[model samples]
Target: MKKELSAIDAKYEAQKIAFGPMYFQAVVALRELGILQFISNNRKGVSIETIIEKTEVSEYGVTLLLEAAEVLGVVEIEDEIVKITKVGFFLLKDEMTRVNINFMNDVCYLGAKSMTESIKNGKPEGLKVLGDWPTIYEGLSILPEPAKTSWFEFDHYYSDNAFPEALKIVFRKNPKMIFDVGGNTGKWSFACCKHDPNVNIKILDLPVQLKVAKANATERDLLDRIDFHPINLLDRSQEIPQGADVIWMSQFLDCFSKEQIIQILENACNASSENTTLYILEPFFDNQDYPAAHHSLVATSLYFTIMANGNSKMYRVEVMKDLAREAGFEIVETYPLIGDSYHTILECRKRA
Candidate 1:
């Protein structure tokens, strides 16, 4: 019993010592392997020699990386041959994979090193780590070569996964038209069209984002039914496109202040008709004692504020109802969308 306990204690102590440095070393190895880009280009698998040659690293370094990757199940090694695993293939194939890598490498990794400082300060130094770029997209734009490609990968991941789920929950029945607010890349709009053939989507977003949205819509064969409208939310005179039965705000409102949210709500109210319904799907903050809830709230809330100049506060269900009421709308219902977040539908009628 004493021998077993001693062995266990030693193992725990060793883990404590190795954990931090091992994680850091893994990041370095990833960068060295050109893993993100290699996976993106090949999508099959690349040998250690190929990685070493492409990344201009030594054979010794490549071997180390291959070993580490095999251990992490990122790569499979047999008979001195290496191949990407299923998870590895999925990560590389997904558009947002690279973007996520860049985010982790540039922002999260560096910021995590100073986690103690952030904990003490009660905020992240994401802006500082990200440099001159204001938004996540802007930061991604300036990334070197393959890293930029990774950004596209990341964008696709969020669009492919999050938007579809949100749209399905929000627009179960076919609607004639949908105004997708902050509809970058028009993924959600495309999703709406996919869900219901009769649906027409109008995407409202920043000019650059609108350009991307248009391209994405075209690629998805949804350009005919989807139109892009360039409008800054801060511009009060900006007209909200009308004749839409659904006003979709998928992953949008969280990127603003209370006043800004109210303004947007008012605009949505004005744009909506008697039969129009406003849909909002976003991460819901649950005041639960569970670790998952706590981690999500803390991590996401901090991320929005520091990185995007936005609030990640999970708005109360009542808060939305009150906002809608003030803006001449009545709450229909709020329910959990497939995952951790909530979906809210607000029905509006113009004041008499």
Candidate 2:
């Protein structure tokens, strides 16, 4: 009798394993409901008849889709009336919306469909899907109106949170001058001036982003204290203004390869004096073999590589120290700040 019971359990497990394909069908059904809310604004919950009339799909197909969405808890349906759930409504809200959904639908979703091929080939197919556009920024430039806006809005949201925390970690003491390398929109520099009334801030970035940053600084009453410098990081021969006590490189290094990073560091070293501090802040990935590092590191690294053409692989603290040493400075200290993110404040003293 016990043996027969064990066989029944094994059959149940097999059935459960066979249900894996249902997962993607469920995702598609939920996406349909999200689209419905996006279109209708969730005013009167979209019924099967309404969906059939509005979408390319038929009434029978609408019913099947709604049934799947109901199981996924994206919507509630009773007496042939359908309504978006709280979860569904929140998902449609401005802050919480899946703004990337359209981008996914147009570009990434198709690439995801070929994820199996990517795994087999050991290289992503996304770049090929975005042919002739050498970078993600270049590809985004060609996208139609709302898609480009949505992508940048998402970028702004992340920078908004990251810049403030990075400022706190780096600008603990008020300094006379700060050089904000690659400072987009002057958010970090503005925050610094607001925190320390006596501090003067300089922002360096592309002319386009700097124009926006200048406008923001003017609006914030920081135009006098904050200055914008349009400079390319690749061009090292251009003179970097001297005598800045703090040089900030926030979320900038990951955009370059190690060799390029070394070149940038070398230039920065030449610009600094004995009392200068170089503050580098980025999302840290522990490169050690220890199982103790946070699980988010792996996911963060892969997403940057595939989507943004970034490499977030962990670099040893010793490597940074060695770079500083080669550049004719001694690393005074390193500090971690604000959650698990590593904000290395490397204070380098110029060799006499």
Top lDDT hit = 1
Q: By summed lDDT, which 10 consecutive residues of candidate 2 come out lowest?
A: 287-296
Candidate 1's TM-score reads 0.63
TM-score attained by model 2: 0.63
lDDT of 1 by residue, 189-250 (tens): 77778788888888988887787778777787776898888888767898786798888776
Quantify all predictions' global Cα lDDT against the true fold.
0.63, 0.62
**Tens-place lDDT digits, model 2, residues 113-206:** 4445544554444545554443354355454555457656645553455555566656666678999997875767877887788899899876
Worst 10 residues of 1 by lDDT: 337-346
Off by over 4 Å in 2: 1-32, 35-147, 156-159, 162-165, 287-331, 337-352
Cand. 1 Cα-lDDT: 0.63
